[model samples]
Structures are given as C-alpha cells and as structure tokens.
Target: MASQLNSGSDLGFEADLFKAADKLRGNLEPSEYKHVALGLIFLKYISEAFSAHYKKLGEEEYADQEDPEEYLAANVFWVPPEARWEHLQANAKRPQINFTDVNTGKERVGDIGNLIDNAMDSIERANAAVLKDVLPKEYGRPQLDKTMLGELIDLFSKVGMHSADGKSKDLLGRAYEYFISQFAGAEGRRGGEFFTPRSVVQTIVEMLEPHHGRVYDPACGSGGMFVQSERFIENHQGRRSDIAIYGQERNHTTWKLCKMNLAVRGIDADIKWNNEGSFLSDAFPTLKFDYAMANPPFNISDWWQPQLEGDVRWKYGQPPAGNANFAWLQHIIHHLAPRGTAGVVLANGSMSSQQSGEGDIRKAMIEGDVVDCMVALPGQLFYSTQIPACLWFLARDKSANGHRDRRGEILFIDARNLGHMVDRTRREFSTSDIATIANIYHCWRAKPDAGLGAYQDIPGFCKSATLEEVRKHGHVLTPGRYVGAEDAEDDGVPFAERFAALTATLEDQFNESDRLTALIREKLSMVRYDV
Candidate 1:
C-alpha cells in the first residue's frame, strides 16, 4: 500500500485539481490510485450532501438527525458519525487511532488507512440497499503510503466541490467525470472499457434524443449514455423523471465505476453486472426499451460460444464464431420495442465487413428496412484503438413512427472529416459538429430535401440512397462509397496553359536543385582539409 502514494494529468476543465492530485500520487498506478481518489470523492460528496440535509433537520424541533430514514427519504445517503468527512479529516494526519470497545472493555489501534477503511465500511453498512460493496476499502493495506494518503485527504478537504466557481456547476460531478477520462487516458485501451468519450456519447444522445422513455444500453460502460441522455433532456427543458435508465455491464470493476459515476450525478438507474456479460447472460432478457443507445466493444473475436448457435437473439442469422459485431447488432435489435429505435457505435468494419456472413446479416437488415442512417466518425476520436468507427441508426418501424415513409432509403453521412484535434493524438467533435450532425439526421427523418430544404444531401458529405442501390453494392454501408466525392471549388485555368506553366515550374525547380547540389560539391572540393 506504500505504493498507493505512488499513484498517478492536466485537462482544461479541472486540470488544476487533477494536477495537484497527480503530484500526490507518488508512484501508484493510475488504475489503482483512481479507486482511491474516486472513493474519497464519493465519500466526500455523499457526506457533504448528508451534512447539508442534516443541518436543516437540526432546526426542526421534532426531527431526529440520527434517523437514517430522514436522509433516505430525501435521497441522501446516511453517513454514519465515524464515516463523516469531518471525522475523516480530523484524523487524516494521525499516526494511530484509539478506539475503546465499550462492550468488550478493550482498546483497538489503527492507522489513518484503517480509519478510512472503517469509514467506507460504515457508510456502506448504513446505505447497504443502494451502495453495497461499491466503495473501495483497501487503504488499510500496509503497502499503501499513509503520509501521501493523508495529504490527499487533506487536499480534498481544502477544496470546494459543489460551488467552486461561484456557480452551481456540479464541480464535484465534473471532477469525477474528468478524473474518469484522465484515468482512461492513462490506462489506454483498458480505460476505454469503462468509458466512452463524452463528445461521442453526446453525439449519440443528441441524435437519438431519448426524451421520455425506457433507455437501455447493453454495453453501457460507465453509464455515459444514460448521463448524456439525462443532460440532453435537461438541456431541452424536459422532465428528468419522464425517462428511465437500464444498463448491463460485464466487468465488475467498470460496473462499480458506473455506479459511482451515476451516484455522483444523483441518477437512479437499474445497472446490472454479471461475469457472463450481456451476450452470454442477457440482463434484461424480457424487457424492451423505447430507446437503446450503446458503444459496444469493437470487433471482439472471442465472444462466440457454442450455446449461442441457436440463441433466439440472433433473429437475422447466426453470427460468426470469430466476430461479435453482428451479435451485438442482433442483440440490440432483439431488445427493441415495435417502435423502438437504437443508435450503435461499432468499428468501421461493421459498415463494410464481408467476413463470415457479416455481409449476409447486413443485407438481411437492409432488406428488412430496419437500417435507417449511418454516420462515419472521424479517426483518432477514441482513447482505446485507432480503428475508425461508424454509427448505425436502426428503427423497428421507421415508416409508422411519425417519420416520413422511406423504408427502402438509408441516409449516409460521411463525417470522417468532421471534428478538430484537441491535442496531438486525439480529435473531438465540437458542439457545433454535434449539432450539425444531429440536425442533418433530424431533417432527413422529417423530410427528404427535395433540393430545397435542410436535408439536402451534399455530394461526398451525405446521401439518401435507395435499397436497390445498396443491393448493387452488396450491402457495404461505408459512406464514402455512396456519398461520392466532396464537391470541389473551381479556380478557372485552361488545361494546356496550366499544364505548360506547371511543367515549366517543375523543370525550373529541378534545375535549381541540380545547380545547388553541384555548387555545394564544388565548394566542398575547394575547401582545405586540415586533418
């Protein structure tokens, strides 16, 4: 645990706080230290929320501040006396804590780590129904650095989380989200296991616009889809309670992170976790959601099993044993209501893959008129792999859901050129970019641009292609194949004159290069060698 001090950045939003925390991480790996930092942040968040509620309860003559139900009724976790942030901060620097056992008439000794662990335990015990075993309690391990841990606790205590910028910016939630991304950046592909980039998630949420319905994510990562959906609703002045959240995550650690991430934002979602995962052990087997949005692991080859050969979820066809791309598509399709719609993020290969019946499955979906729209995402947008990805928009009943009847036509947007580089290695969709893409999809769904409206397909950018056209191409949905070349601006210059001028310039450049080389050799020959 001495290495807990050795743990782990600077992002723009909460870069200063993260920089301070990184300095304190001494040598701890980002993966391990993230739990430590996040666990403390969760502890502090719930403690502070409870403290504020407890203060108000103290003024009520008949109120019993110790009553757990009082906090539970207000949607606040009941932090036990010893588990409070104030109590933890008071003992942060202590070398040892002495506890007198009243029942056993004995004394107990523990360092700050033990105290912190006990605090998490007590809090979990008090809120078992909601937060059972979600908090990390490994700080008590002797291998962790006590001094560094104390400094972290002290550091967090000095900072204001709720209203840092003289505004209710949900800075605590921002910090948690920011830390998840920072840790994801540090962990590389492993981090992608627990997170989807915010802009990518937002793009899906804004396009799908999961307004007032049951939203499901089979590969929900850290609940980013749900969070963004809720944010979208709020941003549009929609009621939060109008929507319900359901998700399933296979990895236990990522599930815990998702739980904490949602908790920080005060979102109540039914997120399930099983080692067998969404594919093998369908979590919401009998449930159909109105909206299903997800970013599944791209092109996983080892997810196939003999038991899935006859699985009912594979309605279109049995997915190949080597790739689960079609399996995920079918699973999401299986879970949609008659009028349900889904937006899925997959490897770009899904758009044009011809391997192992993936092409046949795509063709079947196309013929069934379920494929609605596809958008090609820009490269380098993910922290995980550089495999370019695309979005698959499907609707169960596209013609009858108050949408324009165009069952045979699928819209394709070539957005591989969208988004700007945020740093040297990463690119992100700006707000304008998200809005533009979302608007295009919305306009197309509302009505086809008869060359006079908002949805006109620009050459090499977007197109609404017919089923017959797709059939001619063997169901390869890569936008580039359909969108055509982007229209180029013209600077009128005659072919012969321009060719002659360009040739003369090239000849002159070649002659200048030869002259410079000969001149350099002559000068070297004239120079005197001393040794």
Candidate 2:
C-alpha cells in the first residue's frame, strides 16, 4: 500500500503525514500511540462516508436524513452527532469542567480525553453490528496525555477523506494501509502478530487471483489478505461485491484492528474472534471457501494438540504434539471447497521435515494430488522472525479449472534468491520479482490456449516434477533438490587445461610450504645454540 503512495522521487503525502503524526507521539510507545491515532483515522473515514451519504439524502425529495438505516442501507456506518469528526474537532481544546457520564452517572472532569472516549462510545452504540467492541475507548485513561489527544484529533482533521467527486476515498484507503504497515514496522516482533508484510500478501493474492469467490483466512492478521485481494479485484476493474470475505483471529486487539482495517476500506467481511482460536474452537466450521490464504504462526508447539487428538480436520495425519505445522496445513485443506485453491506461508521445514510424521502427512497430501506448488522464500521477509519460509499452494481440483491436466506433477520454485534487500534486516520482492513468480505459476497451470505462454523448467529456479520423481527423494518437497543447481558460465578454458593448472598450482604451494618449514626449523636451531 505504501508503494501506491510514492510518486517517482517523492515520498508522497501519506508518508509525510505519518512522519508528522509520529513526531507528535512524544514519550508514547508506538504500541499505545497506534491505537489512539488509528482509532481517530477510522473514525474520520466512517464519518466522512456518513456525511457524504447524509448530504445526498437531504437533497432527495422525501428522504429521512436522520434515520440510521438510511446510511446503513448505503453501506456507510452511521456516525451519530456526538461522534462526528467535526464535533470532536470543535471541542478538541475544551477546558476541563465537571461532566456526568450518562451510563454510570459518574462525575468526571470534561477534558479532551473524556470527550474522545464518549465519541468512540457513541459511534459504537450507533453501529453495533460493525463497530461493536471494535473501536478503542481508552483515550480517557490517566496515562494518556489529554492535550496530545486533542492535537492528534486536530492533525487527522486536516486529512481529506472525502471529495465531491469521491476520488479521494481511494487515497484515504491507501493512507490507512500505509499507516498500518508503518505501525507494524515500529512494533517489531509484536507487529507481526497483527500484520503481514505487504509484498508477501501481494504475492499471495497475485498467485491465487481470488477474483470472485468466498475468500477466507483462519489466522487473519489485520485482514491484510482481504485488503490485497480487494486491491487485486479493483485493479482488474472487477466489482468489489463479487467477493465475500471470512476470517478468524485469536487476538482480540488484532481482531479489532482487522475490523477497522476492513471497515475503512468499505469491505464487508465476517471476521470472528475468540480466545480459543481457530484450532480449538473452529469458527466457520461447516463452511468451505473458494480461496484461502494464511500465514499462521510458524512451528507453534501449543495448538491444543491434546484437545484435538481425533479431530476430523486432521485427515492427512495427526500433527505432532510438539508442532502445529501439519495441523495448520490440514485445517486449511479441510476448509477448502471442492475447487478451492489456497496459498499458505509456512516454515521451510514444512517442505521437507520428517520429524514426528510430518513427512508422512506431507507425503499423503502430495499423493492425494492436493499439493499444487511449493516456493521457497527469501529470508528477512518477515518482521516477526528470521526463519526461512516457503509458500505451499494447495488445490483441490487443479485439473478442472480450465488448466492443463497435470494431476501427478507438482511445481517447485526455488525463489530463495529472488527478493532484494530493503533495509539492513529486511528484504522485499520487487514488482518484477512478484510478476516473474506469479507468471511462472500461471503459465504452468494455464491451458494451451490460455495465452499465458508455454511453461518450461528453468534450472535452479523452477521445475515441474512428477510424483515418481518426488518419491525418489523420499517425498522431500524442497525445491533445491529437484530444480538442481544453476549452470555456471563457461570461462572458455578446456577441462584438461584447467585440471593441469590446478595441479601445478597445488604442487608449487606444497614446495613453498616445505621451504617455510625448513626455514622455521633452522631459526629454532640457532636460537637453541644461543641459549
């Protein structure tokens, strides 16, 4: 999303805005400051949408502008009078006074923090279905600075979230996305708990081409997958209503972030949250999705393995008690529609590890013809951990999707050498890199007349391996073993000539070593005589 805001040599307006906002965060941790700033941004987006709709309804012949359903019908969250950005901004610098809470009747001082908290509560009450328990109402906390809260609201008031022609809405969406990424980076390892790298999410969306269907993510962190998928559809000139999104996240805070993220983009999704998580409490249990994408926590040791000992989702095999890699794989597989295709990000070990029957589960999935493709990713692509990762493409019926029939073949792409370093400790896939990888998969899967061009194996890069070839390697799915090393360039020297030169060089080095040894011994002997 930050990529969209750049204009050649300039960092663009959103980047500049985020920098200014970060500067106002004096003595506040990014973790806490993010909630404050993002809450305001979310409020701004919905209020603008409501105001636009309200204006239209007022111009109508006999429309009721005050009715909440009028805004709800247009897919706009109804921002009550007290919760509107203008109201909050108007009272931003209000002096402290005795205030009574309507719900609790608790007498409190009317400061900027209390006013902001009340505004958040009013918004939630007006639109409970979408905003219930999602908006952060912690601005009144004693630790937060009231003056800074008012200043932050004033800062966001300058952001033009809506325009008469409605072109600025897209800009606002991009800015929201950029802010999410910036916050994720600032939060470091904790950030990865709620955000996936934008490039990685883009690559997954490009590969799946989830153009129109039910898309789902079991561990939907901040709903990045849904955002990217929406972008893909919009970029292709498709209608947003064509796709339905479903997601589940264990973390309540991240779930609220996901809700706000999707709401700001005006993408309606059924994102559920609970403490039990997707593993133990399977939300959306009987539903199957057409496209599923997830970056589940890698190598998790406590995924309620004992509680789910005989779960039906473990059709491939029971995952080891000490690891949940196979469990995640099977859960995704179980939730896939008959024609569903999924792209999963997992630790590289999932591609070849044999520990605790993971290899057998992999073997079963491969033999079942569900494993479509495996791509080894470059390192430093994640903010959470530095563990090398890979993408596992699973398709329930690859042969039926107007694609070439290759049921027994799996595509292995060794992309460990692909992405470029973005910083000292991070790497990202360039536009060309993402296109190159996605195009390879498309070509390999497209039918002859599909216009994606013919697929061919490139040494040390990609290979279409047969099941027999896979079995020979003990069902190990690491791409390197199958793709082989890239061929080296010839230096115009004959093999015999090179061998002769190497041996000659070795002989001269040996002779030099012998002379040095004799010189050292003679020196030692002279020193002994002196003693």
Candidate 3:
C-alpha cells in the first residue's frame, strides 16, 4: 500500500525541516507553534497555487491580460504581488514594518509576531474567503521569541515549499497532518477532541465501503473521517468526485481546522460550524446520508439534553441529561438511508450502560433491529480520553442481503486483544489488522439464504446472538460473557494423575512463598544499616 502512493524522488527533500523548526521553539508552546508552522504551510500552498496560474497568464498560449476572471473561472484565488511566495521568501531575512490602523497611526514592527500578523492580513485581503479569519492571530505575543521566529522562517524557506511544482505535491498536506498528530501526542487528554487517529478512521471507511453518495460526520474533528473516506474510494479505483462530503463541528477552532484539512487534501466538503452542536442546532437537519462515520465526544455530559428532551429525533428513547451517548446514537441512526450503514466510535459505557434510561434506549434500538454489530476496541486507541472505546455498526435494512431477514440478531465481536502498540503509549491496528476485522464483519453479515458463507459462534471471538438469546443475557452486549470459554484440553493421561499433579503444584507454590520473604528481610537490613 505504501508503494502505491505517489512515488517520486520528492524534490526539495529536507526531512529534518520540522525538527530544525522545533529547535527554534524557545519558550513557545506546541499549541502556539502549531499555528505558526501550519500557517506557513498554508501560505506556501496558496502561493504555489497562485504561481501556477500566474505563469500561464504570462505565457502567450494562455495570455489573457486584464482578465482576472480567467483565473477565477478555474477556481484559483487571485493573489497580490506582496502576498506571493517569491516576495515573502525574498524578504524572509529582512525586517519589515507592521501596523494595525485601529483608529490610530501606523506603528513600527517591534516583534516577529507582529510581522506574521500583517503577513496573514495581506494574504486574507488578497483572497478573501480563502483564508478569512482562519489564520491564528495570537502569535505576536511577548512569549514567542523573535530569534526563534526568524529561524523557523529560514528553515521553512530552505524547502521548495514556495515553488509552483510543490503545489502538485501533497508534501505540505502530509506535513500539516504529521504536525497535528505530534501535537495530539504532546497534548494527550485534550487532543482527542480535535484529532481522530488515521487508523481508526481507516477502519470505519474499510468496513462501510462508501463508494459513492454523501458521507457525513456529525462530530467531525479536523475532518479526518471524511478525508479517509475519500482516500478509501480512491484506493478502491473509484473517482474522488464520486462522493460528496458533509460535516458539522461544534468547536470554532476545530471547524477551522476541518476546513483547512479538507482544503489541503483538495477535497470539497460543505462543513458547517455552530457552537450549539449537532444535538441542539443540527446543521444538516433534513439531510440523509448514504454513509455516516464519527467519533463523537465520549460520555458527553452537558449536551443540552433538556432543550432537546422532547425532540422528535429521539425515536428510540430519551437520552439522559447527564449523558449524550444514546442521543448521538439515534442522531446517526436517523440520518441513515434505507440501505445506508454507519460506523461510529463511542465510550465503552454505551455498550451496556443501563444508567439513566440508556439501557432502555439501547434495548429499543436493538428490538427495532438497527444494531448490526458491536466491537470492543482496545484501550488507549484514542488520544483524548483513556477510557475504553467501542465501534458500533448500524444498518437501516438487514433484509437487503437475504440473511433470513435478520432483524433480530446482532453480531458481537470482542477485539480488545487485537491491536499492537505503535508506541509505548498508543495502539493502532495495522492494515492486516483492519482487514481481519472488516473481513470478519463481512463474513458474518453475508446472506444466509443466498448460499454465501455462514456465520458461526466462535468460542473466543464472535457470536451471532439472537434477540431471545440477547434477552436471556439481560441485553448486556459484552462479547466475552456470551462467546464463553473454549473447550478444555483432553489428554490421554487419567484424571486421577492430573489431580495429583495439580495438588503437587499448589504445594510447591506455598513452599516458594516462604523463601522469598526471607530474602526481602536481608535486603531491608542492609539498606537500614547503610542509612
């Protein structure tokens, strides 16, 4: 898969550019440095894009002087000379004046922070909506060192980030994503609210197989889910234009990140921003999506449940004002079309929580036959919270596959033991790990009457539990309790001999415990005398 990616020598290769830039981060926080590095990358991308069109205008073949419409017609933003990359790189080493005319006279540039602010303003004026109020304007603070800022600019300039050809490459896009991931790692608990791990997003896309139509993310964070979905279609030999993406993000800063993220990937998505969130003011109220994917904030407390307590969208049961787990579930469920399927990540509590009517809501949804599968994911799979997470797959119509009209059965998979550690602190499923999980789901969901592969109750893995069986288990969807333990070993040795061996093992353990206690006391005495 890595080999299939765009394989070129990667011109202007400065692999350690970000590392060098980091060295200049004297007292600046990564949260602050994030905007600085990403802002420059955004500027570089726009400049390269502008230069590409500017050259064609200069050439005789495409010469159309005095016609800005020529460039606008091709979806290119018009950039002024001062905001262009060449001009910035030329003056990168030189100090420049900076001022804001807020009912006052022009002021001199006393710091690099002020210079960066003016640069962002110049870019915004050149191409209005392209960057309007998007750039982080807090960098001109006293905390950010002037020498460090200069060094970062020089480091970024060394790369061919300003060239027209660089626009065609996703080097900047990849770099931006890389930096976001690094920031997520740095800022552990708060990171999950903004970024979704690429592997988790890929798993959802792989399972849903969103070939075409609208893809939606209700709690889209930095737009990773939608971006991965587009890549999924492209990887499957489908045109990127085959899918239209839609999303809604509650946080304004995250919404801005989502916009920038989608723009960097060259994927057009109509992402909406509102502080009220999807529960209160659903931006896509009337919209039904063919595919839905999200990692909604886990166990969201204070989700304005009182305002939406009697809302019509709650078809299953009213989610408690204390927790929005079931509310997010029904919202995604309501958005699915007749044949639509959705993959959502939620807290482990949602799988079996009976607290505050959550269990009843889950039971109602189960009896209605929308829940297709539930996977218990390993802990530490998220950056935001350490709590265990699970993946929920919901389908609108199970009869489409002719699987005995399976409106009563739900597949439960316990994959808490599946992923491997990518680092000491985080775990991510590999491509094979993803395929293993997706293939299992596809296998179990195959039509029983269609003569395809049949589903089975694997003792240590998956089990297709019926509605009656689910009721017998009191609707607790934990897979381990249902799948049960594997068969006991049957050796040729007699049961009497085995019992004798077990008794001897127990006796040995008791004797060994006594010897270890004496060794501990000797070490304690030596340490006490030395003290």
Best by lDDT: 2
Between prediction 2 and prediction 3, the one with superior lDDT is: 2
Regions of model 1 farther than 4 Å from truth:
1-13, 99-107, 164-169, 447-453, 486-531
Clashing pairs in 2: none
Residues 1-531, candidate 2, lDDT per residue (tens digit)?
Answer: 233323323338788779878888889998888898888888888888888898999999999999988888888888878678888788888867454564575777777788778878878888788888899999888888878877777777776676567655666677777788788788888887788888899999999999998999999989999999999999999999999999999999999999999999889999999989999999999999999999999999877656798899989889898888888889999999999999999988887788899999999999999999998888889888788888999999978675788799999998878899978989999999999999999999998899889999999899999999999989988887788943111232333678889999999999999999999999988874434
lDDT of 2 at 96: 78
Judged by TM-score, which candidate is best?
A: 2
- Which segments of candidate 2 are over 4 A away from where they belong? 1-11, 97-109, 486-531
> Which 10 consecutive residues of model 3 have the lowest summed lDDT?
485-494
lDDT of 3 by residue, 1-531 (tens): 122122334532333555666777777777777777777767666666667777777886757743657766766666655456665565555655444422243666545556566667776665556567666666567766666666666666555533345444456666677667777787777766889888888888888889998999999989889888877877789988899999999999888788877776667788888899999899999999989999999887888645786888799988888888888989999998777889999877787778898889988888888999887777777778778778899999987633446678888887767888978889998889888778777778776555646667777778888889888867766665566732111221233678889999999998898788888888887874434
| lDDT (Cα, tens digit) per residue for candidate 1, span 1-531 | 222211221124366667788899888999999999999988888888888879889999999999999998988889888789998899989998975332244677888888888888788778787688788889989889999889988878765555423234256777788888889888898887778999999999988888898999998888889988988988899988999999999989889888888887778899999999998999899999999999999888899877887899888889998889999999999999999999999887787778898889999999999999999888888999888788999999988576678688999998878899988988999999998888888888874544425678888789999999999978888887789943111121323567788899999999999999999999999999788
Ranking by TM-score: 2, 1, 3
Question: What is the lDDT ranking, best to worst?
Answer: 2, 1, 3
Q: What's the residue-level lDDT of 299 in candidate 2?
A: 91
Worst 10 residues of 2 by lDDT: 486-495
lDDT of each: 0.84, 0.86, 0.75
